[model samples]
Target: MHALPDIVGYLAAIIGTICWIPQTIKAWTTKETKDLSIWANILVLLTITLWFIYGILIGSIPLILGNLISICAVGAIVIAIFRFRSQ
Candidate 1:
């Protein structure tokens, strides 16, 4: 059924979004982002933003929700990188 695929999509989105939690937590708590690449994070943010836009265009709730959350998670990492940059 159509509902089953949407359920799967939502599940995947949730798991994927959650994957960033540990990294975000570590970056914020330790205040250490030296090992993290700013460019990579920025690129990821950009990529997710595009996906979010595409999701909106297609009206896919799962994609929209997932990418929206990803943007926040990755955006936080980017902020952490700048805020905690090594002196």
Candidate 2:
């Protein structure tokens, strides 16, 4: 019933979250932040955080877990951007 749909949702979340890792790693390794907009990433983080909270409220493991993992990647990039950004 709900199992198949839930599995699909989780799979989608996993794919979406995985997409951010390469960018995060690239940014971290290259120490390049000029092209990356801090505000945009911050907004993304905010949205994800809100979604994570919503997932918590709704008791959706996929949403909670996906956002949790995504936030790590995003948070790393954000920190790297701040750390490596040119003055």
Candidate 3:
């Protein structure tokens, strides 16, 4: 019943969250973010943060967990962009 949907939600969340891994890896290993847009990443992070807040309010584990991980992944990308850009 409800459990099935939540399971599906978690699966989707995992898939979505992992999508950032390659980019994060590339950004860190190459230290190259010239092609990555800071504004876009910032906006995405902001959106994910909002989703996380909403998830908290609604008590949705999937949204909360997914967005939390997303925030970290994207946050890392933002940091990478800045760290590499200044150099």
Top candidate when judged by TM-score against the true structure: 2
* Model 1 C-alpha lDDT per residue in residues 1-87, reported as the tens digit of each score: 699999998788789877887888899999989989999999999999999999999999878888888888889999999998964
Clashes of 3: 0
Task: Look at candidate 2 and give me any clashing residue pairs.
Answer: none
Task: Give per-model TM-scores.
Answer: 0.83, 0.84, 0.83
On a 0 to 100 scale, what is the lDDT of residue 49 in model 3?
Answer: 98
Better of 1 and 2 by lDDT: 2
Q: Report residue 33 deviation for candidate 3 (angstroms).
A: 0.7
Mind giving the per-residue lDDT tens digits that candidate 3 earns over 50-74? 9999999999997898899899989
Q: Indicate the TM-score of model 2.
A: 0.84
Identify the superior model by TM-score, candidate 1 or candidate 2: 2
Q: Show where candidate 2 strays beyond 4 Å.
A: 1-11
Model 3 score (lDDT): 0.92
lDDT of 1: 0.89
Segments in model 1 whose C-alpha atoms lie over 4 Å from true places: 1-11
